[model samples]
Target: MHPPDKNPHDMRTAFRREFASPEVWITRTVVVGAAAVAGLVVVGFTWLAEQALGLFKGIASVGWWLPLLWTPLLCGAIVWTTRRFARGAGGSGIPQVMAALDPALSGGRRPLLVSLRLSLAKIGLTSAGLLGGLSLGREGPSVQIAAGVMLTARRWLPRGSGVSAHSLLVAGGAAGIAAAFNTPLAGVMFAIEELSRTPEQRNSGLIVSGIVLAGLIAVSVYGNGTHFGVIHPGPIGLALVGPGLLVTLVTGLAGGLFARLLLASLRGTSPDAPSRWRQRYPVRFAVGCGLAVAVIGAVTGGATYGSGNEATRALLDSNGHVPGGFALFKFIATWLTAWSGVPAGIFAPSLSIGAALGHDVAWLTNYPYAPAVIALGMVGFLAAATQAPLTAFIIVMEMVDGHGMVLSLMACAVIASTVSRVLSPPLYTALAMIQLPPRRTLPLATAGGDTDDSATRP
Candidate 1:
């Protein structure tokens, strides 16, 4: 009687055997294939960006006249593209990612074409912005470009793929940032801190995959060197720690305030509102670029005109005697560059300015351990400015590659972040508020409220 009765499990076993399937292995193969393709695309994009920048540099070297013509025209083109295609690409594009991923904004509606066009627009505009001496950084453009690419690819997938697309876009963007700056950990941290604004992100698996792929691509191309050259152990002292902490707090607060002020100045509705720059089309941008170049050139002799990597190197190495208010000039240049709607990132420029400011503070005050103090300030100010302490700390540590600065960095980061919050929200978040619809923004007037509270917590 027992032998005569076959259980459902036995029937299923026979069915499984009949299929002759290797589901797990096949799935693994598919995953590996997708990852390989994504990795190649990321690397290729980064390489292209660098090449584009080199070409810009070559053209500009011919004469200062090139940028004079190039700045306004290129900026105008970027603005025009943003206006026509991805309205979200109008600013840094990070906020656009946040907006797209926001649950509140999704009325079961995701515009694939908008995303794709935005990415293309970002790449062109950002590259052109770079050529035109905009103070913006490449990380923003890289993220936008990656997001756009992934956005285009997701169009072929099923309808429910929007979430997946968003996650992948965010991951791809992180990879782009990681590759651009050669900071894999920072990339991952950024995805977690800034982009992964939901509980599901823990299991989404996209962040890890995208960051690792991007990091690998960056390392392969850049030979695993830290984005900034390693900092030599330069006169570390316990006495300087106290003063460094104070400076860090000030810088952080200033950074946050500066970011907020810039955002406020660049966004509005009325024709005469502070955000008139958005309405005037390219004219405001032309003026901004002209001013940035003029100020940077007149003050630093063009040394602080472009991205601040080379200048940062020189400043850190020189025991903190960079000329009169060069840091201040660089900060202004970056501010104007971003406010003018150039498609660029503030990541590098912000760090450069923070480092310079820190050094300047230490030098002026005759603070002991000037370099270490300044480095700490860099970490703190950057963290507060971006509202990303962990990413900022990791970035500075990786850039300098010295554990000696860790304690001071932490001190600076914490103080700066605390004070920064008191002053205003992070710059990018504030910028988002200005650019985003009123329904989309968190009430930034009050402090300690999470500006990103609308999105699910990462």
Candidate 2:
């Protein structure tokens, strides 16, 4: 009893008992296989989105007025398809995954939000929005798409497979985020912050494996490069406080306003003529929203269309060189795109808007740390918009390879999130709650039930 037996046969027997169990093998195979599949699926979606954007850019290049015609028609068709066939494939897609994972919802409703059909529909419809020059992101929708793939894998597994649906959902969604942005760390944080309320569960291994596999697919193709390349902003002395505060305040207010608008507009409680029309005739309203986006794109010389990836790059390359009011145009375009009832996301667009804001502030103030300011803008806006500061901060810091600005980025994220919270309840949480049954009013921990999407078209 003083010392445990060092018998080799007993040690081997115990090891086999733990590692060679049937449930262990099944869980490993099923979860890992699903993660790899989800990785491939997310990579395919990224390629499709890029191709769609390329097509839109090519056609728009032919005529400056092309998106004006192309966007409206295609967006109208997209909204029609989303409503008629895959009603659950609407919105940012993160909220849908969250709703499916919510314990408050019944199991029967889970399939509505995360299923094979919904994943396929989400990829197609979101790509359609991109092809039509809508200022939407595929990254947000990737959460639902990957989660759908993982959940589908659950059905193929045998009984007592060791992994719970909740674990699979969290892992797949986190994997999706990692695959989409090549940010495995953000994926883990997002799973903890937005996807799961019960973080005490021992799914750490599951979550890490999913992120690694899904993220590996992206790294295999892109060669492990940072998503937005790298940035070096020299040094920041005492000058950062004023300019940093300006950037944080602007992004915070702007992000909060964006979330507030999306809530009111999507909830059908805006009390505006556009909101009324959207509630009454959704497809027609989508057409109109598309028209607005096209006008913004044309006015911005096509800068306001697409996911703003290239624009953000150019902004990073050139210190605050974007056209005047570029952030405002992009903010409006992104909001309209989200409000159009299409299966798209505002995640990337929010980052793009923040970059514009940072650049504009740099222009106004003539700050030397333009790149740092831009990075701050990205984290601030994203954190404020999603109300997930850690995820936002990590995403920006990793994407830009700006680890040197870790403290600054973290501070900005916290400040922006605080400011945003004052104006709007959590955007993703509020949206997820609306996915619950209208009559039940389940005891979900959401800030606002005032937002009822039932009034809007599915």
Least well predicted 10-residue stretch by lDDT in candidate 2: 443-452
* TM accuracy, model 2: 0.93
Q: Which parts of model 1 have CA positions greater than 4 angstroms off?
A: 1-69, 107-109, 112-114, 152-163, 201-206, 235-237, 269-274, 281-288, 319-322, 367-369, 433-458
- The Cα RMSD in angstroms, rounded to one decimal, for candidate 2 relative to the true structure is 3.5
Clashes of each: 1, 0
For candidate 2, lDDT tens digit of each residue in 1-458?
Answer: 47866764687777886688887677778888999999899999999999999999999999999888999999999988887788888888888888888787777878878888899999999999999999999899999999999999887676866577888888889989999998878888888778877653455686677778888878897778998889876686678878889999999998998898888777766778887787778889989999999999999899889998888887888643567788889999998888888888888899999998888887688997688898999999999999999999999998999889999999999999999999999999888877766546543221112233443233
Q: Model 2: residues >4 Å from true position, as ranges? A: 1-14, 439-458
- For candidate 1, write residues 1-458 as lDDT tens digits: 36654544576776674344464334333333343454555566556656666676677678766666666666666655554554455556666665556555552333422256666666666666666566667676666666656555554444433236556656666766676677788788888888776635432554476567667776887787776667764666767755676678668877877767665555433455434444444445545565556456445655555567766777777543456777678777777676665566777777778888777777677875556766776787788777778878888888878577777676677777777787776666655443333464432210111112222122
Residue 185 error, candidate 2, Å: 1.1
Per-candidate TM-scores read 0.80, 0.93
Q: Pairing residues by index, what is the TM-score of model 1?
A: 0.80
